[model samples]
Target: MLAALWAAEGPLGAAAVQSALGGRLARTTVTTILTRLHDKGAVSRSRVGRGFAYSPLQDSAGLTARRMRNELDKQHDRGTALARFVSQLTREDEELLRNLLGGAGDGVRGGPQPGVGDGPRP
Candidate 1:
């Protein structure tokens, strides 16, 4: 459902989304899923007639990153969790991360960020 919305050029009504899915899911089911996504902050909705038009708030990669951050936030030992996660990353991913971090080294680009309460995390 989210993929369907993400693929849309603009916000879509439930009926449109259902049609996009080839009607495999009922309109109510699509509406329900969109509602759930809206509640989860994964999508945004606008009043459309008596119903609403929905659009994905983030692309797939961004959604995955948000989920990862949420999961990390839930951990009691975030440092340990992040360490383990980085430790398990494939070489390519590890290198990519290092490059990203390196690029962010300068404050203007998204350098090392201040901790919570101090400022935003890059």
Candidate 2:
């Protein structure tokens, strides 16, 4: 449902969401999901005539940050949680991330080397 709402590019009505879901979901189910998402602070809603329109409370980036923070807070060890995250990255992702943090060609000054690249300096 969130994905449907996301693809709509803005607030969506219940019928639009149902149509986006291929009509597999009942309106009540979608409404329940929307209500739950709203309670989770993941969606915002407003009354539009007889029904409500729903939209993401935050963009993708904001949602990701909030979810990441929530996951980290749930862990007993912050360091372990971070290490597990780092371990899950593919080598290419690791390299690109390294470059971003290291400020290699990103225009920022030196921070920390990614310890992965020897590419020609930009």
User: What's each prediction's TM-score?
Assistant: 0.85, 0.74
Question: On residues 55-93, what C-alpha lDDT tens digit does candidate 2 reach at each position?
Answer: 987767678878999999999999999998978877755
In each prediction, how many residue pairs overlap at the backbone (N, C-alpha, C within less than 3 A)? 1, 0
User: Pairs clashing in candidate 1?
Assistant: 104-111
Sliding window of 10 residues with minimal summed lDDT for model 1: 110-119
The total of clashing pairs for model 2 equals 0
The residue-level lDDT of candidate 2 at 104 comes to 50
Error of 1 at 89 (Å): 0.7
Displacement of the residue 21 alpha carbon in candidate 2, Å: 1.1
| The best candidate in terms of TM-score | 1
Q: What tens digits encode model 1's per-residue C-alpha lDDT throughout 16-118?
A: 9999999999899899999999999999999989999999998887898899999999999999999999888766566566766777656444223333124
lDDT of 2: 0.82
Report, for every candidate in turn, its global Cα lDDT versus the true structure.
0.84, 0.82
